[model samples]
Target: MPEHLRALIVIVILATAVFSLAGKTATQLIPARDFKRRRNLWFALTLLAFLTHSFWLYAAAATFCLLLTRRQEHTPLALFFLLLFVMPPATVQIPGFGLINYLIKLDHPRLLALVILLPAFFTLRRQPGVIRFGRLWPDRLLLAYLLLVALLYLRETTLTDSLRQSLYLLIDVLLPYYVASRGLRQLQDFRDALLAFTLAAMVLALIGLFEYARHWLLYRALLGALDIEWGLMGYLGRGGSLRAVATAGQAIVLGYILAVAIGFYLFLQGVTTSRLQRWLGGLLLAAGLFVPLSRGPWIGAAIMLATFIASGRHALKRLFLLTMAGLLSLPLLMIIPGGQKLLDLLPFIGSVEKENITYRERLIDNSLIVIERNPWLGSVDYRKTPEMQSMIQGQGIVDVVNTYLGVALEVGLVGLMLFTAFFVTILQGIRQALRRLPRHQNEARNLGRALLATLCGVLVIIFTVSSISIIPVVYWSVAGIAVAYVQWVRLQTQPHATLDR
Candidate 1:
């Protein structure tokens, strides 16, 4: 925690206590007005503190929400979940500070992971199966996954390191997919989950944006003293006036969520939304993604928007307006340098170490090499090729940024095939949903389709970065809720074959 934030928390507590004691029942008797006043005071303090500790404040806010809320308070809780989902990925490395290390440890993503894995564990009661798979997706594929993991463990010529990794992957990585799949098999769960997440995402995004623009008395007076600015520049390859990440670790995250949000906004309200709202929401999402300056996300957002306009048949006037805007801005982008968010990506485009391209190229090269090694059964610890004399002379584990390769590295060819099977099943499910949606109910499946598209984009981008960087916990938690909600609604109205659909 920042120094001023610590002080602010203390002050808020003191004021709350003092006011309550003066009323009647010690700390519990504070007048409602006084309670709100103190809360507002702390809200301001908290917002300022947020600049320095975006991830922490966001996470705590979500946690506070979880602690205070019951499952019944669906609306508020749903909103809070979205903000939690939006919490930026934390690096949390504290050099020369041992105590702080434990306080904000990133070594283990405990709370986030626990929320998913524990529930799944208890739900399964220790069985190594997708508890809901018998009802939702085919059971054979999941069983195949188990067999694949087992195979990875049993290989004779396998590197010891690969065997250890296969074990971890079977649990740590596989567990999440299992939990999400189970939760989302129900439609109401999916609806409530998405509802909570969407509100939270908007609140977090707006709050972060507000603080950045104003730099109010709370900011100039307090956070300024702490040398913290509420912005997303740090998440960029460069910092200090780069652009707004808005409580996200990377531009891709912001884009992914915004794209999802736009999809939801359109689908939920559909043609009922006012023209003005449609325009404004479009602008908000566009500007939101523009600030993060991530090319992959930009591409994703563009593809989604284009797909939406083309496949879903959005208003032609709006599309024309957007096109005109893009054309008009081209000159400014060329002349003013801030015009091209993707082209001006800090370290990649603007800096001397333009190694981003070459690095990606090298990743592809490394992946090909691994495939060539043991083309069918898979190579052991191909990711950790540093120990092998053939791969690299003195490098660490092969820095293959692609997540597919990462999965392949730990689980081997069999695991990869099982993963491929899982993906195909999901794709089929989504395709079935889209096909079943009525002409009058385009909106019914659009959001689900949009989410699937976003996931596809994310999967593609994860080839460049680790997808589960402690950032994905809250994200997937909420995503599971959405899938559950959608599936539940559909199932309720139908044949019940798919979760009674």
Candidate 2:
């Protein structure tokens, strides 16, 4: 068999095993009526991608997926998450004519969003009673951020190039946020959408574990099967262990997705029927997280747990016990065989990848110096600066690992403030909504807490890694979900309010 064919077989087997083991449990959280339809659609799309020989055919498959889900309640959002989480970021640029020589790169998420999400979002907005996008502060802030960055793009590139880049932002960033914020309105919508994401992540988790065990990237040949020349697929290692990238293109991205899934599972476990099943699901996600060996996400997961604990009842005692348990594990780990090697993989305390830490520190220092040069609108050629140029790695690429610094360097302090405020506003809304919930409304309150913790954790971890692959997609979608939750909470608290669209 061809290499790509073998790789596909491995992925199919791993995904089948994962679904067989935990799929029913994950799908149980969503409505039974919707599950069969979505599952069929998901499999059909996957089959099309698997059998198709060209990128355009895969794009058509994605477009069909979106259109079929258009009229269904929250299925469009579900399909979007399913494709976004399950597929890798394989790209093939559509060649443009004349003055616009370079068109948009239609990656998996971008193809789904551009081909359908934008049109669908506009169609939904035209309806009588649907929730509007910019009515909320987070929505307004996100618009401001996107517009600011788009306008700033004109400083460096041609009008055509800038417009193309702006469109990329619209499809890649805004559509995900818009569909999520507006598509999901009811409690069940939230459950369905989140469950779709979690199930996809569970598949990714299983794939990551398989990759770690085999010391092979099972999905690398996927690009070849599709005949795309994407550069994100490669091998990475830490302390003699191959980091698992799965379909996430990068290990850190995979770890980040698993971390977010684990956070969602925190809320999911509460709604699940079987106690042992949910625990098993959580363990699977945790094990997936470990395979990536991405310390930043590991720290972020810790922060998420702490925040989740603090948000609920018995906050003080649970946190204390959790902290004590962590402290106690240090000595226990030290005495265990090969514990020292494991300890070295941790952040701050870890000796392995110490240079990465130093590089990040220098990135912060250098980025600030470069930002100081053009504090208002930022220099478009910031990457060409001596400070940034010096930080270039052996790969001949200046990897802007820090998302915040990347924002600051690209669009200056103003854009950074807008970007920062967008999340901060969303976080504030989540917190405010959570406070409005009555004590008996534990389920609603818990969902809000999970969103709060997850967003907070994502915010911190992005400081360590750049906004690449599914990282931005995950956070943008979560923020939109947060906005929807806030709206849902307000509707619940109001007199004679109905959540029906």
What are the TM-scores, per candidate, against the unseen true structure? 0.63, 0.96
Q: Tens digits of per-residue lDDT for model 2 on 358-428?
A: 99999999999999989978887888999999999999999999999988888888899999999998899
Name the TM-score of candidate 1.
0.63
* Cα deviation of 402, candidate 1, in Å: 1.7
Please, what is the whole-model Cα lDDT of each candidate in the order they appear? 0.47, 0.83
Spell out the clash pairs found in candidate 2: none
Best by lDDT: 2
